[model samples]
Target: MSRIKQVFKGNSQAIFNIKEIAKICKIHRNTARRYLEILTLKGFLYETQKGTNRIFRLKTRDLRRDSI
Candidate 1:
């Protein structure tokens, strides 16, 4: 999960789909999706639907905080 967070912290304003995150993190897509869902539930990320895809972005509140 920390690895996943690093991806978002690197580009706070960038939004990503599960596939992109999985590729970047070098994890299985399902694993990436689960981590994303956990972050979303924890209020660290925002999830939005783009057609059939679920996109995620770091929350602005999280960006202001040192700890995620």
Candidate 2:
């Protein structure tokens, strides 16, 4: 999880797809997608869909307000 968090720490405003996250974290695409879903549910991240694809961005202040 910290690996995922580290990705956000450097680019809080960046939006990313599962593929991007997977590459950044060096994890499998499915694992990255699952992590994204869990983080979205936990309010640690926000999700936006572009057509058939979903992208994610860090929630900024939400991170401080909520525990992962």
Candidate 3:
């Protein structure tokens, strides 16, 4: 999850799909998706539907806080 947060911190404008997260985190796509989903549920991330893609971004509140 820190890896995902680091990716967001490095690129504030970046939006990640499961596949992209998988590639960046070096995990399976399914695992990436699950993690993202959990983060979303935990109020650390949010999901948006763009066409066929389920893209994710970190919640601004979470970004402003030192801990989530």
**Number of the candidate with higher lDDT, 1 or 2:** 1
Model 2 worst lDDT run, 10 consecutive residues:
59-68
Model 3 error, position 50 (Å): 6.7
Instruction: Kindly list the per-residue Cα lDDT of model 2 for residues 1-68, writing each as its tens digit.
Output: 77888788778788898888899899998888888888888778887765557888887654454265
Instruction: Assess every candidate by TM-score.
Output: 0.85, 0.81, 0.77
Q: Clashing residue pairs, candidate 1?
A: none
Ranking by lDDT: 1, 2, 3
Candidate models: Cα lDDT each: 0.84, 0.79, 0.77
- In the range 1-68, model 3's lDDT, one tens digit per residue, is 77777777777667889889889988888888787888788787788775568998767743666664
lDDT of candidate 3 at residue 29, scale 0 to 100: 87
Model 3 TM-score, all chains together: 0.77
lDDT for model 1, please.
0.84
